[model samples]
Target: MKTLLRLSFAAIFAALVGCATPQVPVPLDQSFYTADKKTVGLMLEAPKAPGLALEGNIGLLDYAIIAAATSSLTDHIEGQDLGEFLAVAEELSQNLENEGFELVRLQVPEKAPKLAKFKDPDGKDTTYFAAKDHRTLADQYQVDYLLKLTATRAGLARPYYGFIPTDAPRAVFNVHGEMIDMSSNQLLWYSDIAHSAYATGEWDEGPSFPGLTNTYYVVMNKAKQDVLGALAKRESATGTLALNDDEEAEATESSETPAESQQ
Candidate 1:
């Protein structure tokens, strides 16, 4: 029986490893830092309305049931004030200003469309946007680089294995930012910030899930830190610009620290 259990768990782990999403990190161009004067167009998307996302292979009936059970919790989460999270833009803008870049806010008439993703030459799906297409925005803004921050979602993520819950629901924040060179429409830097904090106590406190609510804010702050950390400049001992891959890894590790239960 133990051997059977071990094999079953191993198969599940293998399946998860096989199904993991592909990510290609592009480091920030060193030329931006070297340039005497830099102008950047900043486009930040409005944060997505909050709610619970049921992930994993859930059946139709199970999804409905989960939704029904979490309706109140969802509403409570949706009504949360995102002022703190929204302020991240200001913080990011200040960071750019400190780096000696003149920041230009690019206003969009409507929310930007979901970033178009496609498989790369290696057939792996990538988050990088289509090249040369954003030149129009750059031309209009008259900036050397475009810094786009996409706040995809802020809420809870409930992963499941069919009808069974794999773990406790987690308050989550998902955002991704990128820097593009307008001259060549090449991706210079990419940061995918995703942070989740599990509730300290029971997750299903109806009406007002205080513990989960608090955790939500904690995760949001972590996400914000990740965005800033990714943008922070780091140089190697040899005075050469370092790749952000290590910083991204460190951010992931820090964001994983478990949250203490809050009342």
Candidate 2:
């Protein structure tokens, strides 16, 4: 059991793209963060896709190999929500407030209410907002700026198993978020966010398999922390957000602190 756990740990860590893959402030418009913008509301919207399809051909042992390594192929696992989304929101809100930007918690509608996701005139997925209804929401909330976590794609499975270089277990995902001007309905910022936690060939956090929901839980938490760091402009550099400083305080302090639950 101990040896198996160690092997599994090695397998997971092997797949991690540690301390990289995210660029902060996400290269937003210069005007997004101005001198007088007071309040900002958060819209948490993202597609949760789990179990990227395995791509390749394999013989009999393939079945057992895949079975042992992956949790599910294409079952829409939604993976799991270890409360990372809410944590991200909470962190952002607090960060903005500390920076003198008022924070407003917007309610995620029960139904699809009025989504702001669509192709724009520029032939790009430039801005996706719910047109009139979203504007109404903005008006109702009285927020000056709206930040939307456009998409957070996370899961624990080898998406391009055959195409990738190595066979190791790592928590991986492609996540991005943006800021928007509700009045003009424009994209203010954007970035491709990624995070990872390489298992250390030991039961550091807990036992490990080839991959599991728990693996992503650990990974997403790290990702959520950086999302706040980037938006707060604290992690403006192109390296991992430094840990041994005051900038890391919130990421450390509030990680266990859950945001108000959402639907």
Candidate 3:
């Protein structure tokens, strides 16, 4: 009975993941990032307790059982004094400062729906939360833009195919982040990125689960680095605007110099 259920679930899960279309990210618009809209409300999701995610195929009953069974283990992992999650968040805050953004740190209900997926007019798959959905947050914070880093999931990921392990378990960290224009409800930027790392040695360490724990931190750091990298690309784009301005000024001066020489 269990074997049959597992197979059924695995086949469905595999098909779902396999058939899903990839989504293209919405790029940050240069005009929206201008000095006129320097104030941005920064919202970061609160971290949740770590646990295992079963992928491939698994029945709902079995999934629930496993989740309940691993609750204690997840709790222990969460209590290990591994470290605080502040470093990357602080790094993000500092980067926004360096970019001349007036950061207004704000809090929203952690569980509030902040994103939605849909096809744009061009029929390209894209993810964005409705602009009006965040209007209250924007109005409350009195900011014209909102930048959000949604909650993260940190734990082990095991992929299975019909009662067979497809690959070794890995530590994973994932989150969805976006920047939106509150006034127009335009999604200025959005990206869904994840990082995972495998254990270097024995992973089934009993009470402490050190190997998996270490890998968890590895992916966590990588995930944060991913955010920084994406933000840097956007900042670099803003720098291009500055470069264009300089070139224009030089062009104007050169044109005037030639006119004076002709005079």
Candidate 4:
């Protein structure tokens, strides 16, 4: 009976993951940056997925589980980055900044205690990390734009064939992420994907390893790249950026021919 149940779920899961379409970046709209604004706040949230589980996980004893339990046992563990996520907004600003907003840097004292809260109690876009006094945050740093980035929600699943693991079976990885424009309190872009063949590069067959498996890093990177690509600035004609007043004066003096003074 127990074996039947595991097989049943695995079959259903496999069917779902196998037929799913590959996901891509959302349609980007640079039009949202139409306002005269500068100074952007970075909000990179942590990823989370509460329900996904790994089957047959007992560390050194994984293969030793009783026949039934071996196929039924499951475990789950979360992944986190040291500080790699902090620079996303800043990196994205190389061209976007010139569009209008400059990302605000947070020093030790200036950093917020919680700058990555995901959602509210109701699973809605509460954005608790965005400081209650939005106006104050904006005024303090003169930040007119706040780019709130929800962490990529990563989930993992290992599908089985008839309660047995196949040769190098792929793992399913799904992520849903978005960018919010706090100035208008609306979504600027969004992308969500669930894939194994495409997300983990299991489709291509040129290079094959003896036992290469997908890890959190692989899945998370795919999701992260999607966001970066979606937000990437499109190449376009642009004028020379205006320099600050001091630099402008220095440039003016340097460009002048030393007053063509009598020598």
Better of 1 and 3 by TM-score: 1
Per-residue lDDT of 139-244 in model 3, one digit per residue for the tens? 6778878888864556667776544557876877776788877765667778876777778788767678788787777666556655665665244535532323
Tens digits of per-residue lDDT for model 1, 97-143? 87788888888557654434432344344325444366656556899
After superposing candidate 1 on the true structure, give the runs of residues whose Cα lies further than 4 Å from its correct spot.
1-23, 109-132, 161-166, 235-263
In model 3, pairs of residues that clash are: 10-57
Q: Judged by lDDT, which candidate is best? A: 1
Give candidate 2 misplaced runs (Cα > 4 Å).
1-26, 45-81, 111-136, 159-169, 196-198, 202-218, 234-245, 248-263
Question: What are the per-residue Cα lDDT tens digits for candidate 2 across 108-164?
Answer: 666865655443556354444323334555667788777767444455434333334
Query: In terms of TM-score, how similar is model 2 to the real structure?
Result: 0.55
The lDDT ranking, best first, is: 1, 3, 2, 4
Stretches of candidate 3 off by over 4 Å are 1-23, 30-33, 60-75, 80-86, 110-137, 160-166, 233-263
lDDT for each of the candidates? 0.69, 0.54, 0.61, 0.44
Ten contiguous residues minimizing lDDT sum, candidate 2? 202-211
Model 4, 39: alpha-carbon shift in Å?
A: 2.7
Return whichever of 1 and 2 wins on lDDT: 1
Q: Estimate candidate 3's RMSD in Å.
A: 12.9
Clashes of each: 0, 6, 1, 2
- Cα lDDT tens digits, model 4, 1-263, are 33334434665676689775443344544555555655666555544332233344223233233334433222222233313344455666764666666776433334554444333334354222221334334445455555556543333344344345543333344445544455443445556644443223452232321121234444444455445656655444562333447646855765683321110
